[model samples]
Target: MSTKLELPIQEFTTPYPVTAREDSSIEELLDIVKNLKVRHIPIMSNGKITGIVSDRDLRIVSALSAREKFLVRADDLMTSDPVTFQGNTSIEDVILEMSEKKIGSVLVADEKGDLQGIFTVTDALDVLIEILRGRK
Candidate 1:
């Protein structure tokens, strides 16, 4: 077999994934995240990925709410204009972007302007380990 390792991200990434509307309520966003069992949820505006909110962000918001005791909307809580990755971007490039941004995940989008899956640090690390182990 060839030594070159093939990346599974291309197949693992869920193209046209579920997205949260900018106007979506925090409760709705929470429901989606819980149901989908995903850490990062892309916030879409005008059919474009505008921002992202991770489980960490949500927990922070929730903790703050518990202290101050107030509810917040998704738009009010999310990190706006989060870094995004194109589908064609190499796995290496994605890793670099996440590192430079100091973020855990990056939203994936396509040329037609649709929400694709998310690439988390976990995903990148999986790829890295696979490559190091010489697994195709």
Candidate 2:
């Protein structure tokens, strides 16, 4: 049987993931997260990825009063310069980096460094489940 780990990460990546601008308001971010059922959103500027924001980050700022929340933007809560890997990178390599860095997700870019997708912890779990099932 072919081990899935040898495959390129792009094979399992969620391509063209939903993205946000640094200037996006908390309300807008919340709407995207709630409506789309996504846990992370890459922050893009001029078609380039600048940072990333997660639901956990949002929760931290959600405790603010209504007016305070309105004043917050995605950049305020985003982790700037998130780790990224080429789409053709091996799945094992990406997963290793994620585990070592304790990061929930990593951005996938193309040869030109254009954002292609996102691979999150949930995605890894799903892949694990698939591999386990195949073992039966």
Candidate 3:
């Protein structure tokens, strides 16, 4: 008898996560984040994943003055070359990596290194909830 294996990262990922361009002003990106109500954004360049930006990152540099915020760009504050994973990655392994590295999110990419989705700690919680509910 064979037991079902843990699901892949794709099953627990937020597909087509909100994205930002390298040239996007910090203020503009902040607006996107606020409007979308998302905490993380993949920084893209030429349709490829180049980096990532988080609300925390923005908050660290944002000031009371609007001009100060506008002075910064996504490229100026983004975490460059963030860790990325494939959809086929095992959910267990991804969780282990995230835990060991103490990271909140990982970019999900295809074989060609194109942006696909984002797997975040929040997504992990969803996976747990589904498992507990016997939905997976």
Question: Considering every candidate listed, which one attains the maximal TM-score?
Answer: 2
User: TM-scores across all candidates?
Assistant: 0.78, 0.92, 0.91
Better of 1 and 3 by lDDT: 3
Best by lDDT: 2
Candidate 1's error at 34, in angstroms?
Answer: 2.5
Ranking by lDDT: 2, 3, 1
Sorting all predicted structures by TM-score, with the top scorer first, yields 2, 3, 1
lDDT of 2 by residue, 47-101 (tens): 9999999999999998999999988999988999999999889888999899999
* lDDT for each residue of candidate 3 in 1-136, tens digit (9 for 90 to 100): 9664568999878999989899999887889889998888999999999999999998887764787777788998999999999999989889889999999999999999998999999998888898899988
Go through the candidates in order and give each one's C-alpha lDDT. Answer: 0.72, 0.92, 0.89
> After best superposition, candidate 2 residue 32: deviation in angstroms?
0.5
- Ten residues in a row with the worst lDDT in model 2? 1-10
What value of lDDT does candidate 3 attain over all alpha carbons? Answer: 0.89
